[model samples]
Target: MDDGDVLTSAGVAAGLDLALHVIRRDHGSEVANAAARRCVMPPWREGGQAQYIDRPLPDEAGGGTAATREYMLANLDAPLDLAALAEHAKMSIRTFTRRFREETGQSPAKWLTGQRVRHARHLLETTDLGVEEVARRAGFGTAVSLRQRLHAAVGVAPLAYRRTFRAADHVRAAAAEEKA
Candidate 1:
């Protein structure tokens, strides 16, 4: 509904989204995400997205996945599999799988792919690396795989994503280098 210059939300959850929108709009996404992290909330969720999901949130009850999560992040490029992750967590496959889903609200593979994509997005935004190089760095193996995953996730090709998210400071640095 429209109210003259006024904003409203459907509920308390929606209010969080609205507040995040205001913060992101004014202070930028990095700041907003940092604030969200401090509160132990997930990163930016758009207003139009589902307000609730069935999976248990990290703030809810769960355990034994934290150390494994850190290890996976530090080795995103590694060829990780269920057995390997389970071994790292010192649990059997069945137990690790259950605990992972409970803690992260997604399967280990899904979470790993998302993390890889996030890292790919970061590399694309921050560096001038070719798509193939970014793919290798981000563990996609080949440019075709990178293209498919990046497109499916963000609806953009790698180069286009680079252009979209290129940091302003990087542009200035490039310009300065060109002058020198």
Candidate 2:
């Protein structure tokens, strides 16, 4: 079978290990191993390496962009305009917009929407909040807007995604309790 034709397991962590293996193969064992260590993940295994993992963000940046990113994450539920973000970063709007895209490969608006969606996902997974409350807390302004954004990002409505992840989380928690 071709490389593209190959198939493997079906779990998130397994896919992480598989990707790590490819990284190790292409970039050298030391670099990949170092990355796993930094993430506090276990070493990769060959057998369980065919799952779907979420893609991670890019590496760190040296500029003030990191501070801006931290601020964005911290204020995910707050109303953030370009001017506000620029002022926070102590840069002019034009310069901040340019530098933010250069550093993150996404416009400020797009990045903020992405962060809000992620925050909503976490709330959906971990909390018993209603969809409208999650929408409000995640700064999407309205449930309709939150539905649109979440549907665009994950190809599923917020409730559906929440049901799936919530069930999985419950199962995992039950298994962990049993093990204990």
Candidate 3:
């Protein structure tokens, strides 16, 4: 292969495999593994989206609590509760709960927790913050809470997660510096 070479595969499955192979070679297995785990994707699918597969399409219908959801995302560090969310949405508690479930397929608390975990994961992968700092930034209130939540969500400790992603980053940075 040459510099700036382009290789195209015939099918989606082959393309996925080629993409993963490139990532693995460039970033190492730990980074590729971390990407696969965090994306909940296998890196390559055997038969890409076959007719018998059950893949739900995106929801084109918009309205109902989307604004509130955006607000929640913005104020992740705030001590938000069901009552706060309901008030923001101008919905009664019961009505908000029902609508939230219908829209997200999860309870408000569950969804919020998942989002917090995702934030924590991003911090772990991208930042050099300590666990306690990451917890505070991720809105987990405390390191213990962050650890418990992370364990429950992704079955890995914060340090381990950071190691997998950040170590790969450090390696890439060093390689770039060396080339420079």
60-130, model 1: which lDDT tens digit per residue? 23479888888888887778899999999999999999999988888999988887888898898778899
TM-score, ranked from best to worst? 3, 2, 1
Error of 3 at 73 (Å): 0.5
What is each predicted model's overall lDDT from 0 to 1? Answer: 0.80, 0.81, 0.78
Which regions of candidate 1 fall more than 4 Å away from where they truly are?
1-62, 167-180
Per-residue lDDT tens digits for candidate 2, residues 1-180, read: 116547454467766777677778779989899989987897666462222235455455675667888888888878999999999999999999998898888899998898888889888888999999999999998899999998888777889888877888789899999999
**Model 3 over residues 44-146: C-alpha lDDT tens digits?**
4564332212223224267487778778878877899999899999999999999888888888888888778888888888888899999998889999999
Which residue pairs come into collision in candidate 3? none
Summed over model 1, clashes come to 0
Which lDDT value does model 2 have at 62?
Answer: 70
Top lDDT hit: 2
In candidate 2, stretches whose alpha carbon ends up further than 4 angstroms from where it belongs are 1-61, 169-180
> Who wins the TM-score comparison?
3
Model 3 lDDT vs. the true structure?
0.78
| lDDT minimum window of 10 residues, candidate 1 | 48-57
Candidate 2, overall lDDT? 0.81
What is the Cα-based lDDT of residue 58 in candidate 3? 21
